[model samples]
Target chain A: MKQFSKTLLSIGTALAILGSAAAVQAETIKIALAGPSTGPVAQYGDMQKIGVMAAIDDINKAGGVNGMQLEGVIYDDACDPKQAVAVANKIVNDGITHVVGHLCSSSTEPAADVYEEEGVLMITAASTSPSITEKGHQLIFRTIGLDSLQGSMAADYIANTVKPKTLAIIHDKQQYGEGLAQTVKDGLEAKGISAVMFEGVTPGDKDFSALIAKLKKENVDFVYYGGYHPELGLILRQSAEKSFNAQFMGPEGIVNADLAKIAGDATEGVLATAPKSFDQNPENKARVEAITAKGEDPSGPFVFTAYAAVQVMSDAIKAVGDTDPAKLADYIRKNEFDTSIGKVTYDEKGDLTESTFLVYSLHKDGSKTPAAQ
Target chain B: MSEASLYFLQQLINGLTIGSTYALIAIGYTMVYGIIGMINFAHGEIYMIGSYISFIVIAGLLGMGMVALPVILVIALVIAVFTASTYGWAVERVAYRPLRGSNRLIPLISAIGMSIFLQNYVVLAQGSRDVALAPQISGSWTFGDPQLFEVSLSYMQLLIWVVTVVCMTALTLFISRSRMGRACRACSEDQGMTNLLGIDTNRTIAMTFVIGAALAAVAGLLLGLYYGVVNPFVGFIAGLKAFTAAVLGGIGSIPGAMLGGLILGVTEALTSAYFPSEYKDVVSFGLLILILLFRPSGLLGKPEVEKV
Candidate 1:
């Protein structure tokens, strides 16, 4: 009876060991998707989240990289830098090695160091400030282009294509807005198109009549606003109300349906510069189709880029055969992975090797159409 | 007129438009302070709530088939006023009334707390993003030639100015001629004495909040309509500016509040036009300091002799 009891205990221990082994083999790879999931800019974060979800769905359905399932965790930074650092710490504490996130530059710039120090691979989906990648962090990579490219493209279009004599450059004076505005100003000056007035306006200011009145006196033929939609919409409306008729343009920050809803008729004929959306490329039809089938809008500025980010990271993990963040970052930096958005290749700065910005005009119906080349 | 003069006149017009909205809100601050001797820091939140009420009403009307502009305006105004007044009464009952016997600091802190609470409550209920409304009023009338500087006024601005004047006149008449208005004045002068005389000073104070909140609602409604956008935090800056106007005009004087608001608005507009636009706020605040230095009682405030 004693021998039988001992034998039974040994068998139970053996079964427990086997179960632990199976659990180890079936472990899911955790990926963190952090952004402003709940604030004023929640819509922007949702676009990236939707894109990441689509990629994860596709990858897992096809049997995730190396037969391991990819599990995603969402962290809300609310586009706040302080909260983003906390999220980065949380991701590191959770032993997460891969991340595709931090939609705004304000959040991304600070969070990048935390991930880099913790040996985590990060791919920011939408932060465009040149300063973000300019630090040359080895672990940081972005799927989207820098504001420098977009700003210069906007200036070039304004100088050569639109060919206005005098321009007024206005910025919201925040980090992203001011950086983009300064770059555009420099680009315009290089082309000998000096702005009549370059000024900074406080964001969330309801009254721009005084500023509009000043701009009207300058009689500038063009107005380039480096801000998000709310203030831009107000500027457009107040300018129109004051009879300060000037062609208005803005950066990607102005690319929102809410702009039209706020500016109303003033939104008509407005132009903005943005990276090529997925819907614009014929090669992305299949990818776009799958994304839309998931009840998500695949046409947003970040959706395709976000998808590309996830795809590149997943492919790198497959190439490395392990979840070591250092190896994954090195692999991503060295390889040119084909993605739903296009080819993904990085420069030494971890930004896209080549990026293009296109000008889109607002139609009367609040939809944007790419301008004819 | 020269182009410069036309430009000056145009800026003045713009200032007056914004000034009228400030005046509407400033009255709330002044009136509440007059009777209660409390700032009613949450008065701005009342205005914000009013804007939200107007926004919801208009959206609801639009959803209910094809609605005409005038009908939408009337319904939105009535509903916004009623709802905002109720909020004011409730806020006073919950935040201020309990702390009435406490020192001034306690009630002041309570008012600030209420302000923050209301701001966050709206943010949670609505959203942090600005709610965009389609421009309901359009078509501006221009006064100058196309070649020279043009002074243009939109139909919305005209409506704002007219409504402000009518409201101001009505409030003035109510204060001087009405029995309730006299009771309010008596409470402001001496709440203890007024209470002793069977005037129901508490009721009068509550009424003061109601009146102030209603006036702020008008400001919020017109502000949303004029700008075509409203947000939860609109009250923070607007409230501060209105407070400055109230203090500049004479804290408890209705006429002083109006004068202060107009002065603040026009001065800000002119400064932005002539100097760097960033300094416009500085000039407005500077005017407040200057007014206080010369006449501490405010522009239209009566001199106060301290009774020993």
Candidate 2:
């Protein structure tokens, strides 16, 4: 029995050594894909995943970066702030030095602190809250434009193009929603057009009749909703049923095809300011084809931006010749790169130098066309 | 109608529409608690499953080019009720039946566990993203002047009202007249005595679950089409609200659930109309607290008499 115990111990030690040897020889850099993989907004996480996976696949196919293969490790934050912080810690503990996402702005802001403090490099592809980049973290960056920029663009369009007599502003009372609404309100006030009514609606509410009645009573000709698609879809459909004749607009959060599914014909003529559809870029034909061939959707606004995040990370890593986040952050801030979202240049605050938000009129058939600007 | 009246009337209509659905879900809670003296916490998830089943059935029928709306609605309703009823029976059998007669807290904990299990089950089966179905009902009847304000009764709202009234009437009649309903009443009144009298108390208890589940399924189909969106987590809040409705109406009283649902819905709508919409939940829940503090037995609930 003593001899058998000694043999078992020897086998365990040998297997441990073999495992370590294999891990050491792989020479892979792990990029953590952290986002909502199990909540209401998990579809947005899927968009980030599609973009990151495609980028990783293409990078590895071309002999990798700095002779090291890129690997993606997924972490589901469920789009909750607390969960994102936990995921950030898990990624740090797992020795992943780079992250491509913490998708929702509310989730991203908290996780950004952890990544910044830990000296981890994170380039969020979708979170647009300006407060994220405003914190001035050295290792934190984003490929998406901020809500302030998008809000200003929406204000510009509403003021200059689709001018109306009386306006109403409604928000879902969430951080992302309320912040964007405030920005748009500020921009509109600066333009000398004030909303007749400014109010908040609960996020998961299925009833909007009372709200609609108030909008009609207020005689608002144009309504701007600051929230994700679900509530706005119900509002739109309910508004249509009541024959409310107000023009409606929202931000990129309501730009998905699901809006049309929820609101049906009411989605027609609804305006949204979203990042220019990067999947349709003529330069991204090959990448788009590759993603589509794998039966994945490439049309989400975040898809190319997430792909750009991976590209920038790899390019910086290649230029710096090491996986050190500080060196990579320094290189990324100073250099320019061509990506699926077009030429990218970062400001000192790590936000894009130029904005990409544009106004599009959604149709019932789930297609969007650039509104006359 | 004057503009103020029109607005108030519009809010009332909206309130009643939402209230009726809450009443439907509340019945499941009230009936289950009445019989077993334990809250069926998983009742809400059963409603959610009903929504998913209806969504699936509708999507399938639409995919096969089934454009006849009434036919599709009927088929989805039948399947959702049947499947959700089965789930309701299974939950009671698997989670609550074995724990019966144990410490009341044991069954309560088992109920919570069952709730979590059902939620995760739906989440794993259907991805957590919101699945939207195109609004199947459209158009409405508008009243008052369009220039000042319009009070509109949507066709979907009308359907919800009609279905809810019919279900409530049928339930009232069944409970008052049918042999199974009498058995249910007997079990609720005295389970031990009912069993002593050779009544299958277990089957009666299961029937209560099945009946409550069927009503909830009807509600699920109605709201899923009304809102045109469903997610696995949607049930949690809806369940909570319905449970609140059940408690406020007198936890074990059938009519109390209906009254509580209407009052809560109207309170929410009026609060949103007058005050900020964000405070609507606070106002409704605040009303519940006031009721609990003042009328501990609920508006219609009889005071319990403990046996010596």
Candidate 3:
């Protein structure tokens, strides 16, 4: 029995040596960043790229993963679910142990299943659906808070701050939009706040009068939409033209610079809830300065999360003392890493321990500034 | 029921104004296809270019802050129409003309290539960020019994509707009455026979493209004013919808295109209201399937007997 155990131990060591010989080789570690590189929501992909690349670059410079330089490969899934799964297959096939992103909720959600099955850890900086981590993929982690948190926070703010008696809710009916809208609506209902009207608008719509007119008659004090900037901008501009005059509110999707352009002054006084704004925090001053010194904007809250994703991955690899996927994922769950946002510890479900949100009001002169907490 | 009535009426007006713009865009598709028997796939990009041209012109004007509302609309319309005509001509000469007599698939492929190239070129020229188009005619008039159900008529909407209708009527007159119109119709009947006759088929084809492009430009300008934002890639989905509009109205027929545009617009508005707005295009394609399955020739289209 002792001789058989000795033979088994030797086979394990041999296999370990062979595995090391194949993928990591004790000299180099590889990670991947995946997102939409083209198509409509490419800006979201751009943010993913910027976050992952910045993090990867910073890590390699700072003595990456136990004396081995961390290398990165980018895969463009164009934010489609089908393409995202294909990217997942490639990531597994290519033997990347760590990943920083799969941008959109649809893309990230499906890929999470694959990542879990393969034991490849994904720490996405921005996929904001509640159902994403609901399947309980321990290998999957997100730096950005889920839509449920943001949505409930938005609803709380609307109920407490705005105190609008008759609220109206609209959504683009996307997973992000519709899901967030429902979360907020439920939160509002829990607070005894009732929306007079609730509906959804299509993206790329040129007209929103029918929806705006509903808000008009109801005399709604606030209109909360869960969608990206495009339809939100149109709703604002057209609502003002039609003189609906109800205050507009939304999730982080409406906080983009494009909102100010599309809706112009009509976007004034409009409120949107997002993750804690990086610009408003004096604590993040040096981080902002650091990013800008490189001639890039780090004022966007998610940018820090991207930087943190790279930090966490590198730290995990270092903790494990190797680049094996299983070991790296185990290290990730067990370790609490410092990030640009704050110290983050993941639950067994791979969600952050604590998350917060902020609200910003759009200004007339093409600016959006944070609202008082 | 009064609340629902008012809502329906308001949706109808909004749909009509939107429909008018679609009608103009559909005319361009129908006109070009009638003459060439090929879908001008780049027609949507032509519209997008028109919007950008008007945006640049209007931005410059707004920077000066001199032009009145009427003057701004006029100049934007004229600039969009004129600039788009050049794009139309260029598209024919560069992308379509050489491959004209080849298999239909070849021209379709070339048209798609041109569409993508122009979209990317615009994106490169102007960043992907949507530029704010603050069209100044935001003036409105509200009407209701107690004024509780207020419906507004913005100057921008009025201008879009006016330009769309005027362009549509002018185009109808041009096709029905003018010499070039006859040449267009003759070419649609038989390109070879018309070529044998005194018509300058190349010039006529170019003109068809120019006129179609011009209409598409007006549509773009109208959308920019209505939506109050312009992006380089905005033409993609709108163009696909307009092509669908052209097909639904009977691709090569003028009045049919107009009807198709109205139907698509109204259907979209109502669908957005009643169904999931994100799936609004589902209705368009669904209607398309139903129409094709039942009629095959479309709502207003005549049966073209198979040659074989």
| lDDT top scorer | 2
Q: Write the per-residue lDDT of candidate 2 for residues B134-161, one digit (tens) a residue.
A: 7788888888887778788989999999
Residues B1-308 of candidate 1 have per-residue lDDT tens digits of 98999899889988998899999999999999888878999999999999999989998898897469999988999999999999999989999999888999998998899999999999999989889887778888888867877778888889999999999999999999999999999998999999999999889999999999999998988999899888899999999999999999999999999998999899988988998776777778888888899998899887886867
Model 1, span A1-373: residue lDDT tens = 9999999999998799557645864667878999988999999999999888888988999998898888787899999999999999998986788899899999999999999888989999899877887776889999988777878888888987888877889998898788889988999999888888888887768999989988888888898988899999999988877777899999888988888888888899899997786766888787788878878888778887888888998898899898898888888778899997778798878888877478999865679888855
- Candidate 3, residues B9-99, lDDT tens digits: the string is 7777777777788888888888888888888889889999999998888888778876686697688788888989999999999988898
Tell me the tens digit of each residue's lDDT in model 3 across A1-373: 9999999999998798558657765567777889888999887777666666676677777776677877677889998999999999998988776888888888999998999998888988888777888886778888877667888888888888889878888998788899889998999999998887667776776677767765666778788899898888888888878877888888878877778778877878889886776545676676567667888766655677777888887877777776676777677778888776778888777788777466887787757677866
Two-chain DockQ for each candidate model: 0.65, 0.56, 0.44
DockQ of 1: 0.65
For TM-score, the strongest prediction is: 1
Which residue pairs does candidate 2 place in steric collision? none
Q: Count the backbone clashes (under 3 Å) in each candidate.
A: 0, 0, 0
Evaluation by TM-score, superior candidate among 2 and 3: 2
Please list the Cα RMSD from the true structure of every candidate, rounded to 1 decimal place. Answer: 6.0, 6.6, 8.8
Question: Model 2 - which docking category?
Answer: medium
For model 2, the superposed segments whose C-alpha errors exceed 4 Å read: A1-144, A282-350, B65-68
Q: Model 1, which residues run further than 4 Å from truth?
A: A1-132, A135-141, A291-303, A306-339, A343-345, B65-68
The 10 consecutive residues of candidate 1 chain A with the worst lDDT sum are A17-26
Candidate 2, A188-278: lDDT as tens digits: 9999999988899988877898888888888889999999998999999888878887999999899888889888889999999887989
TM-scores for chain A over all candidates: 0.76, 0.76, 0.74
